[model samples]
Target: MTRNRVLRQSKLLCAKGVFECEDLTTLNHGVFMSVKRKMSDEIKSVWSRNGANSYKEARDVVHRVEWEDYQHWLDLQWPKK
Candidate 1:
């Protein structure tokens, strides 16, 4: 599939609270790990800013931030040719 179409579908999934974005399955292991760590930090920041007392309280916002971060990493890794 075309890159833009794939990105669009993945973003739709993200909008639906899908936290993982492993669409480009061949992503380097180290890079994936790095992105995951970055996402964790973003989640923590959102959780604090929103005063979320528990994982459940931070669920929606965390998922959205996680997806957005992951998507951004994906874009950087696979910039349009």
Candidate 2:
């Protein structure tokens, strides 16, 4: 999605009292789960289709997920309790 959309969603979530007072541990767990799911699918796809490029593909997928997770954290507005 675009930056604007993300900002909008963040604002809406905040307004709706969804993002505020969240449990940090739960949030991190969810992010980790998301990354794990993406990595699992990506790695399996690459490993099945091509043997030679599988290593590189898996690495790229992992890096992409890590970057995305970082971006996600950056976008969040941690509400003070």
Scored by TM-score, the top model is: 2
Query: Candidate 1's error at 18, in angstroms?
Result: 4.7
Instruction: Determine which window of 10 residues in candidate 2 has minimal summed lDDT.
Output: 46-55
lDDT of 2 by residue, 4-77 (tens): 46545765887887652322355454544444444453443321111111222444542333433555634544
**Ten-residue segment with the worst summed lDDT in candidate 1?**
47-56
**Inter-residue clash pairs, candidate 1:** none
Candidate 1 residue-wise lDDT at 29: 35
Q: Which residues of candidate 2, in runs, are more than 4 Å off?
A: 1-24, 43-57, 60-81
TM-score of each candidate?
0.26, 0.27
lDDT of each: 0.40, 0.41
